[model samples]
Target chain A: MENNRGNKYSIRQRILSSKLTFTILSIIMGLLVGAIVLLIAGFNPVQAYRIMIDGVFSRTKYISYAIIYATPLIITGLSVTFAFRTGLFNIGAEGQYIIGALVATLIGYFLELPLVIHVIVVFLFAAIAAGLWGGIAGFLKAKFGVHEVIATIMLNWIALYLNNYLVMRPFLRRPESESSYDILDSASITILEKWKYSETGREWLSAHPYIKDFLSAPANLGFIIAILLAILVWYILNRTTLGYELRAVGFNKDAAEYGGIKVEKSIITSMMIAGALAGSAGALQVMGVTKNVIMLPVMEGYGFDGIAVALIGGTTAIGNIFSGLLFGALQYGGPKIQPPLGAPSEVVDIMIGTIVLFIAIPKLFKIIMNARKRGEKNAK
Target chain B: MLNDIGFIIGTSLMYAAPLLFTALGGVISENSGVVNIGLEGMMTIGAFIGAAVGYYVGNPWIAFIAAGLAGGIFALLHAIASVTFHADQVVSGIAINFLGPGVALFISRLLFNGSTMTKSLSFSAKMPRPLNGLFRSNSFSDIIFNQYATVYLAFILVFVMWYTLYKTKLGLRIRAVGEHPASADTLGVSVTKIRYFGVILSGILAGFGGAAMSIAVVSNFRPTLISGQGFIALAAVIFGKWKPQGAMWACLLFGAAQGLTVYLGGAGVINISSQLLAMLPYVLTLVVLVGFVGKSVAPAASGEAYEKGE
Candidate 1:
């Protein structure tokens, strides 16, 4: 069924094939696997899929909320993808996320500035803080020759405890409250009551009444920024010289070095950008959703999740968007799976783990390729 | 202050115990060329199985053996995946990490009700009050000396492992295989067999380490409690330069850092936020790892899977 004769292709198409096919396949594969998982759990796969679809596309509010949920994942996923593209594994996204949020939280709490400036300051400071946090691993890797994987994992612990310490110390939250001081209305993304309801369908089942009152992905305008950033990332990767050098380094360090690329510099820069992306995610989450940085009990574990996102996305920019959305859906749908079947929230995590396992098993793809080759030969 | 110093050292020593076992586990596996990233999970599993067996069988010794056996079995899975099937060592290690927690969570859930957390034993699972009225008039001796049996075992394991690795023939082959499997293969050593033994030994050590946490330190099993100690074990593995004695010191030092965090958190000794103090051990790993990256060479082929035919 393959057309060998129509082999002529432009340079753009080759790049597109490497990026697009994987993105499409990952999205489709994640969904299909997710569906199978749901089916095995005794839920109708179709119904579960419909619930997720309805959750996202069923209303304007849902879509906004879905976009909101996707905000940090998109940002964090991009952060991860950026590093992967540069051949660095920044598994400390969680740490960077926390440090970013902590910076923003500290800023948002003390500052009484006007809304726009307040949000901008919070996000910027957070990004800088997180970038520096990630830069440590990069710095260590470059200077000391330590593996980023080991160092970043260590960093995750430091972040977890560091955030916990913040929650307990100077930022010691009130006894009844487990969070930081709430930000002023300027920093918060309170959904406008006017836009709360579904514009298309005002009916009871058509719109969720709780959608207006509930928490969001990244509450504020950060989701919009994250989406716009993805487009920019696409441009950078496909249209910039820096992107080419970074990618060449990622594809083969020896070859890239031979090709006159400063591989080490590229790695450090990539890690900084990756950290910045994750930090932005933290900023968005703190400003948009939480309004202030509320120290949670544990590090959000999003960075660890981001690894899976980057991997399944083939570590590409645009591909990360779809794969991230897929991951986001699984994460969002995870809570929905509870209560009915009495499964723990960790079941979703277990499934995510399994999906990572399935993905890592490259033999499945090898077998598929072999079968296709055999078919082609038999046809000949 | 003397009591505090004594307390800190004592708790640090106590914390060092599990970490020592874990690092030894790291040493065992890495010495054979497999990096056991699942040590934390393996430890968790060990804790559960140890607790369950110890609790039911009424014999803590049985718990230790059962835990080691269970850990050996888990190692077998890694052995097959990495050695025979030729999976990426990191990938397989990660898979075991994922699988261990899930299986533990699932099986724990099946056995317990009302909470996802495993129920605490009727008594401390493996911890026994030391001194046994040897100094009924002395609170100091009881408080300082009394701790779990596992804690003592972990310390003993440090020397045991060092002796086992450096002063033994089997350890030589294990080290040789880990360093250069191809060269070792030509020397007529069963490269695969040694690697399998190395990884399995690691699982057992890690399993015992996990048991220590559940039994000696926490006295219970819970999600997120191990809190990346597996990596700490890894750091100890590196910080010790992959040597048992050095790793034990690192583990004790890191463990003390942990004990200090808790002590200071409890006493408010440092104005440093408890969260910041909590970050100490992990942050310190970086500080430690950076202290000697190139100087401390790993087993030459630590993360690389050894393929026989290749």
Candidate 2:
């Protein structure tokens, strides 16, 4: 009996110290907090959650929408994770994203090229534009010792207003519309879009309604590209010499400098790569989803949401994919609760906020574990 | 021309008040070794609560105080996570940002019958202008002096903050704690207590900043109303090199830029796009940071979690 109790305590100790256990505990705590808030607001928490889950999973169409939502989030999360690994915070991802979309939209609308080549051209230009946009902050930090947070924050506002200005220009704006003109057919990345909507294809798909329903949404190559990029990012971080230098700089700039790593070069390179990743996300979003840049009165928050995704994912590439999907599902399905349970959709935000808050305090888990150990000792 | 200059000064002061309050908060918290980047979030909650209370209670003073209390409550959460639990200050601050708007919108929807915005307050319910009738309408003095009471309070607070931070024994202790908490701890000062006081006080001032916006500048609470103002204030804190008086000047410069944008766009004095005009302040901030202020160092112990007896 003594041996068994000792084994149980050790197991509990190991579980409490593990990262995965911490994440799970944070999530559960978030949900519990959400439920308490719901109860106070006079809503049934269980019913609200049920509605949310059903909304996301009840139909193939809804699942596609969730994946669609997750695509940009996953890519941007990877962007943030990459910067974080290099000891930099790329808060300028939003600006880079805007620049990417702006460049892609301009190229897609103006250029006349063949199918694959046009898409490649658009993406390349977009990446370059956004890479430069992000590189500006990196350059400022490396050269002048200005903090990246302030630089990036300032850059974000510039990008926002610049996007609006460009979109409102006579050449860019669609006739009688608030948004820019849509991309050419060759620039689109929607999966089998032509065939999916053609008369004969629709007739054939009628027999397979599930596939048809899934494609009915703007299901595109973005998610697949995002997954592939995640794998690529993971490989780069784990397997490459460049990744080594960047991680070294991240760990300790002084140590890395002593070890002959050019810290300034690493900072700039890391930011550029991170920017390209975020830029690609914006390009893909334009090619596959919106197809044009629309003027925004406020930020769309894709980049801000990326920060949450990166933090929740433990800053791992693989971890980001799962967290991105979770966030996507919550965001996509949050409104379902509003329609039926009469609970505000903002409850999802509260839940995510609470999760992040809990995750910020890993010491809380340690305190809990210590208390448990003391309680067991007392009982003996 | 005189009226235009008066309008410019008046508008600049109006815009500067909110940033001044929040930047002062940032100055205090950071001076005490706690980096309160969550000032934006605190301001957001304060804005919502201020507007909601002003509309419902029909008293601007009560609404302003309520807003500060709401901000203080959120700041306490930040203090707990970053101080007591030894969490990363930046991460905790980010969480506060998320929680602030989340709670604000949730409660707003609940209270306002599913609307995300609080009802607009009446002019009588809005912040009072103590100097309104002291000068003729549209005169230079009227434009410069006849402002909301919050504006006056914000300026006075700056002086008070500067005096407290520089002249008092408590101020010396707070500065010592920020510069080197270990040394201060050795000297018998309580690092934790000072940090808690700094963080919570910062939150209260940030709350007042939010109320300044909601009750004095704007009359209603909406999602976008307080957007980016907190961040701009943050930049002011950095621009001012973490000094209260310095931050005040930085905020005034940014505010003047804003005033210029509004004036140029509304008056059509320049044919530039409004979007382009709106970008001026942000661009100017970057230029000034790069060209004039090459390096602005933070407090020595800022953002570091202190372990007692370590």
Candidate 3:
């Protein structure tokens, strides 16, 4: 029998076909599995989901609040997507977000300028700082072929320290509070319309008829940036030469090289873009949600959640938005799930993790079996 | 001032000691072909179970042994899933890491009257003063000799790992399996068994590392208290270039960096933002990674499971 070694269908088609199928299947699979777990735990699986939906979208107000909640995640999700498209797993989004937030927050607090320039410079400063942070990892990988996973993870720890420093050191509160100085009001991204907050925020809770008092969320403008960036990222990834090179490299390095793409430059650029998105997300959170840049427990785990979002979305920015919305909803309404058996918000995390675990299986097993079969053939 | 240098080395070793043990374990596991990303989880479980057993049993030595066994079982889960079932190592490892604290916290709440942390049980596990006295002067002896026994074990493990990796046939098979497990299977090496051993060995060391934390360093276990130390050990492994001795040095450097962070941070000596100063070691780890970027290559099949045939 002839060996089909390496002559399998091209990655391009497999991606177009299999990835879509895998993604849909995984989502369904995750939901089903989670329902089963819920059922076994003696909870009404269907009701739990209803409550979940209710938590995120029982009213127009709720949905608005959910989007506000999803803003930073969408930003970070786009960040991860940008790098994934280029075959670089920029796991350091958390770090970049921290650095970006700290840098921009310092500018927000210390420097006085015209509101427009102040906002523009702060945002740009954040994006640039995060880009440089991620670029360092990219630079190392490009120059030395370091595994980006290891590099990015380490960077995350560094970010934790740097962020901690900003809150405690330069940006430390006048009274040593675990916060920075409130950004100048001119630079602060305030809610322009108080009525919208009444409609979409915790203020609306007073009007909630049944159990409304229990639900309150900070409805902010970061969600707008999240959605806009998601759309923008979709365009960049699907309709650009840069995106072509990136996907090409991710598909097959040798083939991408053959196609005349500069693999190294693409990786570095992709990482930079990933960092920028995360940084922007960080900046927006300070600008939109909180008036001041508080210490990390603010951005906590959102960056990591971006990985799950990208995976759940199968790495497409559009798909990420849907998944991001779904994730945002889960997070938004999670703590509100009524208990006897509501399970902590971690249940959603476990569910998300289980889905990714399922997806990682086929890829891992295929390579193992292929090598074994080759070994068996060689032995014979 | 001169004694401060010895004191720093002594203290750094004490701090790096746990990392060295864990990094050594990582070398064996990765070299033998299991990714063992669950080191963090394994270490945590070790800390939890060992501390629990120690608190209940009132014997620190038993806790030490129990920690190794506990660490091994957690790792065995990783081995069964990834080594036998051919699951993704990273994902599986993450599962274990997440499961570690979650399950431990759940049990701790139920058993310990809802106080998540075990009661304090501080007792020095340092080596005898006599051992250090013979090698160095009285001052050095007091610094090094009075350290935990784990320090000696870590030092011994480094040399032993080098010997096993180079001199022993089992080590050779382990290395071969990691690089090309399929070939090893053809030669009747039982890639699964080798991988299992590799992972379990990592667990044992990691467990001991955890035991070091509980018995020697903190002498108490808090929920999530290890706080990413296993990852630091992982970084140490990369810095050490996947070799036991190199990893030990890496651990020492990281430990010293951290020690200085604490020492200076405590004294308020470094006027930099305590936050920035605190972040220095983590940032240093990132810088160290750049040096490791291209220099270190993992075993070819480190994270890949071995299947018999299509």
Candidate 4:
């Protein structure tokens, strides 16, 4: 019995110390904090949370919307995660994203080509533009010893204004609207978009109410692309020699240099790839949902959200998909609580913040474990 | 023509004041070896608190102080996570950034009857213009001198900070702790305490910067009000090479660029688009960083968690 009890205690300690365990605990703690905040603000926490959950899962359409939101987040999260794995903090994902969207919008509006080729060209140009945007920071960091953080932050602002300037131009701006003109039909990536609107297809969808509802959303191939990209990133990081070199550089730059890895080229390449990922997110967003670029007074925070997703996901490719979905669900459902429960949508922000905060201090778990061990020792 | 120049200078001072306060905060916190990217969040919280309190209490001074206190409270979280728990400073800072704005907006909506923006303060409730009646309206002197009280406070604090950093023993200890906490520990200085002080102080000053914008520059707190000023101040801290006076100059330069944008937009003397003009400060900072400021080294022990006996 004594041996069994000791074994149980050790097992509990081991489980408690695991990263997955910590992540789950942190998420729970975050929800608890959100509940407390809701309670203090004179709202029913249980009811609010129920509404939020219902908002995401109540309808097939809602689930599609959630997925739609998750698509960009997953791509951007992968962008940040890739840069992080290479030991570079790519805060300029926001800038790269903006550049991608801008380039994609320009291409999608101007270019008239065959269907498959049109979409491919749009993605290619957008990715290249954003990759070059990110590469500028890498170049600055490599050659001039400028910090990536500052360079990226500045670049984010420049990108924001550049987007605004381009969108406002007479050639791009939609008449009587704050956004750019919609992309050509060929450039759109929405799944079954034309078919769903067609008479025969509408009749078919009407017979299947769930499919009809799902089709009502701007659901596109972005999610599939995101999944494929995540798997590709995973394979690259785990398999390729380039990935090995980048990981080595990330682990220790001095050691990587001593080991004869070209650190400068690696940094530049990592940033470019990261930029391309973020750029792809923007391109997909334009092609799938908005279909046009809207001038924003402030950052829309897809990139910042990516940072949170990457952090929560443990900077893993697969982990980002899950965390991105979680974030997307929260973002989609957060507004629902505001309308019905009279709770603020910012509650979602608080929950996300709390989760990130708890994750940051892993020592809290260690402290608890140490105390528990001491308690056991004292009881014995 | 003189009026336009005066107006531009006034606008520059108005813009510079908020950044100056925040940059000073950055200098102090960074001097103590903490990288505070969350200054933006602290400023956001401060902006909201200042506006909300000013609207309700009808007293700008009280609102400003409240904003600072709110910021300090938030900074305590950063200090706890980074200084005590040995958490990643950047990660902790990012969390604080999210929390600060998140809590601010959540409470702002709760208080303002579901609106993200706070109610605007009356002119009397806003930050008082100190030299308002001293000079003729629209005169160059009036435009330059008849500025918000926070503007003067920001300038004064710069000198005060410069003196403290260069002259005082406390400043020396803060610097010593940042430069080499292990050595500071050997000398019986509490590294943890000093860092906490530095971070919290930074938060308070950042809060003041936010309040300066909300209560003085404009009239109310909106979602976009403190958008990138915190970040610009951060750039100023870097551009200034981590010196208090240097940061002041950097803020002034950025502020002047802002003034130029505002002046050119309002005056329409130049047909430049406002959006393109708005990119001036950020672009200039990047150029300055690349061309002039080669490698601005941070404090020796900055961003590293100090472990005892390690």
Best candidate, DockQ: 2
Badly placed stretches (over 4 Å) of model 3 are A1-69, A112-121, A170-172, A189-216, A295-299, A322-353, A363-380, B113-116, B122-140, B269-296, B307-310
Higher-lDDT candidate among 2 and 4? 4
Query: What is the per-residue lDDT of model 2 for residues A72-156, given as tens digits with 9 covering 90 to 100?
Result: 8998899999999999988778888888898999999999999999999999999888888889889988988778888888888
Query: What lDDT score belongs to each candidate, Candidate 1 first?
Result: 0.72, 0.90, 0.74, 0.91
Q: Indicate the DockQ of the complex predicted as candidate 1.
A: 0.39
TM-score of chain B of each: 0.91, 0.97, 0.90, 0.97
Q: Which candidate wins on lDDT?
A: 4
- When 1 and 4 are scored with lDDT, the better candidate is 4
Q: What are the TM-scores, per candidate, against the unseen true structure?
A: 0.84, 0.97, 0.81, 0.97
Fnat score for model 2: 0.70
List of clashing residue pairs for candidate 1 = A68-A217, A69-A217, A161-B275, A164-B275, A165-B274, A165-B275, A219-A288, A219-A289, A220-A288, B43-B210
Residue runs of model 2 more than 4 Å from their true location after superposition: A1-12, B293-296
For each predicted model, how many residue pairs clash, with residues at least 3 apart or on different chains? 10, 0, 6, 0
TM-score of chain A of 4: 0.96
Docking class of 4: medium
Ranking by TM-score: 4, 2, 1, 3
* Off by more than 4 A, model 1: A1-3, A6-70, A112-117, A169-176, A189-220, A234-238, A251-259, A364-380, B52-58, B65-77, B129-144, B268-276, B279-285, B308-310
**Alpha carbon lDDT at B163, candidate 1:** 84
